[model samples]
Target: MMITALANPKRFLDLSRTVSPWTCALAVILLGIGFYWSLFATPPDYQQGQSVKIMFVHVPAAWMGIFIYSMMAGASLVGLVFRHPLADVAAKSAAPLGAAFTALALLTGSLWGRPMWGTYWQWGDARLVSELILLFIYLGYIALWNAIDDPVRAAKAAAVLALVGAADVPVIHFSVDWWNTLHQPASILRLGGPTIDKAFLVPLLIMIVGYTFLFLWLLLLRMQTEILERRARSLMMARGA
Candidate 1:
């Protein structure tokens, strides 16, 4: 009901203008605290030592990479099935952000792995390969949106691609469990609960929340821009016609 009401561009713009600033402030505050706590407050791991600190950044990024793509897939589905006006806009706005997070996850994971696994990247690793594939999927989605001139046709095609590529999200998530990999199994979210120590877990959780809010703030801003750009193009066409 609420979402339907906000589907109107004016209403969405109004709401986003009011909310984005607050979300941005919250993101900055929470991320600042999380980074500080993770860097200074937490104790070093017995084995990995300072290297374990990378988990604070790497884990949240990996989670967001999967999460944002999942969100895009859902939005794409809504746009395709129900023909929601803003759904495609929302999905399109998220692709670059998702790609960045996925790339960060891979980069940080590689940095962490070099010390632990004695290699920067392992091509044979399922988790690594699946995650890399996710980045490519994001890039492909972005490219598909740009390649087509018609907005409706582009949305439809991109939605289909998003739906098909969603298969990789699960593959990336379960890769560690399904196959032997250098990447560790789920520690923060699992059947038995987080395996990490309280000192590490607290900051990690904070960072995750911070990252989510950051994504929200950025998504809202991006969506607003997309709407305005489309409106501008429409206005120019009307005047020219």
Candidate 2:
């Protein structure tokens, strides 16, 4: 009910305008503190030296990449089943952002990998391959939306694709353990608590919070932009008609 009400473009626009600045502020502050702690405050690893610092950014990005996709898929499902306009908007808004995060994860992982695994790229790794597939899924959703002329049809088709891609999130999550890959197993959120040292963990936790806020900040901006664009397009079409 609330989502449907906010689906009114004017209401959404007003809400987004009011909230965007705060989100941006939070994201910036968190990112600054996170990087400072990651680079200067965190202690070097017992094994990986300073290279382990990459995890500060990469791990959070990887988490966001998976987390955003799942959210997109869930929103897509809601749009498809409940027919909520905001749900489709949320799902559509998530695509480009999720793609960027996934790309970041892959790039940062490669940078970290070169130092740790002695290679920047690998073919047989399940986690890497699954994540790469995730990027493609995001792109495909965007493409599907653009290819269709009618917004309703586009949303339905894209929603289906997004839901299908949701299955891969689990695959990405378990890939490290399931496959004999170079990627490390889960820490922090795993059983028996985090195995990471406190010094390094603080920076990592800070970075994670930073990355999460950044995602929220970007998502709000993108969704608001999309809402405005759609409204403008609708107005233009009405005038032409």
Candidate 3:
């Protein structure tokens, strides 16, 4: 019922405009504080040296990559199941942001890997392979949307694929934990409050919050734009006759 109500594009756009400014403001502050503390306050890793600094950005990017895709899948599911209008918009709006985050994760991971692993790339690790696959899935979803001329068919098809790719997220997460991969094990989310020292952990957490808010900010913007574009098209078609 709630989702159906928000299916109206004008409502969604008005809500987005109402909320986006605050979200953007919060994102900037969080990212600023996060990076400042991460780079300056945290002690260098005894082993990885300043290189460990990358974790503050890398881990958060990776988390967002998985998180965004899951959101996309969930919204897509809602769209298909209840025929919720906003659900498809939310799912479609998430793709580019997910892709950007995935790309950031890959790039940062590679940067971190170069010094630590002695190579810029690795194919053997399950985590790495799965992440690469994630990037492809993001591209594929967007491509599918563009390929179809019919909006309803395109959204439904893309939703199905998004749901499928979203399933891969858990598999990727578990692959790292279950398999003997060259990638490092999870540290922050362990049974104990992060295994990391306070100085480093604080900034990493801040960055994660920053990145998450960043996505929300952008997602709202895109969703609003999509609403306006759709409305304009509707008006044009109505006038043409």
Candidate 4:
């Protein structure tokens, strides 16, 4: 019911205007605290020492990379099936942000890997390779969106790409378990519960929430821009007609 109502562009714009500021404020506060706690409060890992601090950024980024793509897939599915006016906009708006997060994950993972694995990258590592592929998928989706001149055709093509690319998400998640990889298995989210200490877990969770809110804030802003651009285009077309 709520989604159906917000499907109206005006309502979505109004709601986003009202809510985006709050989301931005909350994200700032949470991220500020999370960073401070992660850098100062938590003790360094006994083995990895100071280098373990990278996990604070790397882990949340990796989670968001997968999460945002999943969200895009869901929105794409809606756009393709129901033809909701804003659905394609939402998916399209999220693509660049998802790509950025995925890129960050890969970069940070590589940085962390250099010290632990003695190599910046390993082609044989399933987790690493799958994550790299996910980045490529994001790029491909973005490229597809720009390849076509017609918005409708582009949206449909991008939607199909998003749906098909979603198959990589699971592989990335379980890569550590299903194959031999240098990446560690799930420590925080697992059937057996979190294996990490409260010191690390607490800040990590906070950072994750912060990142989510940040994504929401950015996504809303991007959607607003896309909507307004479409509106402008429609107006210009009407004037020409």
Candidate 5:
């Protein structure tokens, strides 16, 4: 019910304007706390030592990359099926942000891998390959949206691609489990509780929450801009007519 009410473009714009500042503020605060804890406070791993610090950044980015794509898929579903207003806008607004996070994940993962795995990147790793494919999928979705001239047509076409690409998400998530991959399996979320100790886990959770809030802040800003731009374009068309 609340979702339906917020579906109106004007309401969405108003709400976004009101809430974006708070979201940004919260993200900044949380990220600051998270980084401080992770960098200075958390004890280094006996095994990986300082190299483990990279996980604080890389893990959150990886989580956000998948998470944002899932958000886009859900928005695309609503747009393609129930024809929810602002659904396409939400999906389109999230794409670039998702791509950035995905790229960061790969980059940080590489940085982590160099000292740990003795190589910057290994193509043979299933998890790495799947993650790479996910980045490509994000890029392809954005490209498809830009390829079409008509906004309506672009949205519809992009929705189909988003839904199809969603199938790959699970593959990426389970790649470590499904195959013999260098990437670690689910530790925090699984049958057993997190294997990581409180010293590391606490900071990691803070970073994850901060990353999530940051994405929401950016998503709202981008969606508002899109809404305003479209409204302006419509006004120009009406004036010309």
Candidate 6:
């Protein structure tokens, strides 16, 4: 019922207008607090020395990469199954953001790895390889969407790819545990609770929250742009006819 109501473009636009500002504001405030706490307040790790600081930025980005891709896949499913008007737009708008976050994760991971593991890029690492593949999937999804000029066909094809590509998410998550990999196992989100110290954990959580809000803010804005572009296209078609 709720989904049916929101399937209308006008309702979706109004909702986007109402929600974007609050999300943007929260994102700014949380990121400010997180950065201050991470850079100034948190203690350095004894084992990792100063390199542990990279986790503040890298961890949230890595989380967002997977989170945003999952969101895209979910939206794609909704678009495919329910034929909701905004679902494909939401998925399309989210792809570049996911790709950006994924790239940031890889770049930051390499930076952290260089100091700790003696190498920036490890081809043998299962987790790293899986994450790299995730970036490629995001790129391919975006490409598939753009390659088709017909919007309906493009959405259908892209949604199928998104659904199929979602299989990689679990592999990416469990690569550390399932194989011998240099990437560390889940620390903050594990069955036995976080082994990380409180000083680092608190700020890290703040950053993660901030990153999440930032993704929402960006997604809403991108979706709004997609909506407007669609409207323009429709107007042009009407005029041409």
TM-score of 2: 0.88
Return model 5's CA RMSD, one decimal: 3.8
- Each candidate's TM vs. the true structure? 0.91, 0.88, 0.89, 0.90, 0.90, 0.90
lDDT of 2 by residue, 26-93 (tens): 88998899899888877777777788778887888878888898899999988999898878988898
lDDT of 3 by residue, 53-94 (tens): 878877888889889988999999999998887788888999
Which runs of model 6 end up more than 4 angstroms from their true locations? Answer: 171-194
Candidate 2 wrong stretches, greater than 4 Å: 123-125, 171-194
lDDT by candidate, in order shown:
0.87, 0.79, 0.81, 0.85, 0.85, 0.85
Candidate 1: C-alpha lDDT:
0.87
lDDT of 5: 0.85
Clashes of 3: 0
- Candidate 4's displacement at residue 167, Å, is 3.2
Worst 10 residues of 5 by lDDT: 185-194
Model 5 residue 178 distance off true place after TM-score fit, in angstroms:
4.4
- Superposition TM-score, candidate 5 onto the true structure: 0.90
Cα miss at 226, model 1 (Å)?
Answer: 0.6
Off by over 4 Å in 5: 172-194
Better of 3 and 4 by lDDT: 4
